[model samples]
Target: MLKIFKKYYGYQWLAAFMLGLVLPFIGKLLSVSGLHKVIWFYLIINGLYTLYLGYSVRKRGLSPLILFALPAVFSGISTLLLHLVSHQYGFYFGLMYIVLSLFTFFGDTRDDPDENQIPVENGFRDLKSETKNDGQVSVDGNLKV
Candidate 1:
C-alpha cells in the first residue's frame, strides 16, 4: 500500500481533497463550528502546497505550471477574500478550487517528453557471442556442454 501510494501524486492529492470535502459535512453533523474552520484552514494550506508543486514541476519543464497554479491560487485567495467581502461568492470560489486542483492533480505533466526523458524500456537487446568447450555456465548465462 505504501508503494502504491508512492507511485503517484494523485493519490496524495485525492486524500487531501477528500478530507477537505468531508470535513464540512462532518462538522455539520457534529454541529461544531471549530471543525468547520479547521477544514477551511486545511483547504487553504493544501492549496498553497499544490501551488508549490506546480512550480516545482514547471521548473523541470513538465508544463506551464503558471497556467494551472495561478488559477488555483487565485481561487484560494478568493475564498479567503469572500469572507471579508461577502459570503455569496465563497461557494463559487470553493468550486473553482476543487476544479483546478482536480485538473492539476490528474494532468499529464509527467507524460511530457521533456519531463520523462529517460527511456523506460528500449527494445534493443544486448548482443554477445559465447563459445563453450566444457559442461559449465558461461559468463553470459549460456550453457556449455
Candidate 2:
C-alpha cells in the first residue's frame, strides 16, 4: 500500500479536483427542498476534499510542499472570507479543513523516515558540567580544560 501510494499519490489531487467539480450537482440533487441543505452537503464534500488533498500531499515526499499548502491556505482564508461576506454558516467547515491541512503540513514528517532521525556520537558529553576542583566551580558551570 505504501509503495502504491508513493508511486501514484499525485493522482489523488487530480481525482479530488474532478470530485469537487461534481459535488455541487450532487449536493443540489440530494437537497430537494432547502438551499441550506444543499450548502451543508457542499460544505461536507468540500471539507473532505480538502482533507484528502492535505493527506495526499503530506504522504508525498517528492512533491513540492508549497504547491499544496499555499493553495489550501489561500482557499481556506477565501472560504472564511466568503462565508463572512455571505453570512453562511455551512461554509465554516472550510476553516476546519484548513486547520487539518496545517496540522498535516507541519506535523506529518512520517513520509520521510530519516527526516526526524538524529545521529548519535560515540563519546559525546554535555558541554555544561558540574565538575569542581578544590571547591572552585567554573563560572559557566562547564569544566575548563
Candidate 3:
C-alpha cells in the first residue's frame, strides 16, 4: 500500500472526490445544518493542495502541461472562497476539478532516470596514459610533433 501510495499519491484527491461524490448527501446535510464551515476548511486545505500540485509539477520541468494545473489551484481557491459565501460557483469548481483530474490522469509527469544515466565508458578513457610518441605528429596532425 505504501508503494502504491508513493507511486500514485497525487491522485489521492481524486479518490477523495470520488468518495465525496458517492456521499454527497452527507455534504448537503452539513451545508444545511450550518456546518459548511468545516467544509470550507477542508476546501482551503484542498486549495493549498492544488497549489502544491501545480508548483510541484512545474518544478519537475513539466512546463506547458504544468500550466494545466495552475487553473486548478486558482479554482480551488475560488471554490473555497465562493463556497464560503454562496454555492453558485459550485459548477465552476466542478469544472476545474475535472480539469485537474484529467491532467492528473493523463499528464506524463514522471522523470525518466535513464535519461540522466551517465555513460560508463566515454571516449576519454585514456587521458592519463602517455602515448608511445608524445611529441610525434600523425598524418591527421593530432599530436604536437
- Model 1 CA deviation exceeding 4 Å by range: 33-39, 56-91, 94-145
Better of 1 and 2 by TM-score: 2
lDDT of 1 by residue, 20-65 (tens): 4443344446666654444454456545555555544544444443
Instruction: State each candidate's clash count.
Output: 0, 0, 0
Cα RMSD (Å) between model 2 and the true structure? 9.8
Residue-by-residue lDDT tens digits, candidate 3, 1-145: 8677556544544534433332233455565443453355335544445555554544454443433343443344334543332345445544554455455444554554455655767655646655776585679988775
Regions more than 4 Å wrong, model 2: 1-10, 30-40, 62-95, 108-112, 115-145
39-124 per-residue lDDT for model 2 (tens digits): 45445555566665666566655364433542343244333433311225333444555665566656656666676755567433
Please give the ranking of all candidate structures by TM-score, highest first, separated by commas. 2, 3, 1
Best-fitting candidate, scored by lDDT? 2
* lDDT, each prediction: 0.48, 0.49, 0.46
* All candidates: TM-score: 0.32, 0.43, 0.35
- The TM-score leader among the candidates is 2
Residue 105 lDDT, candidate 3, scale 0-100: 42
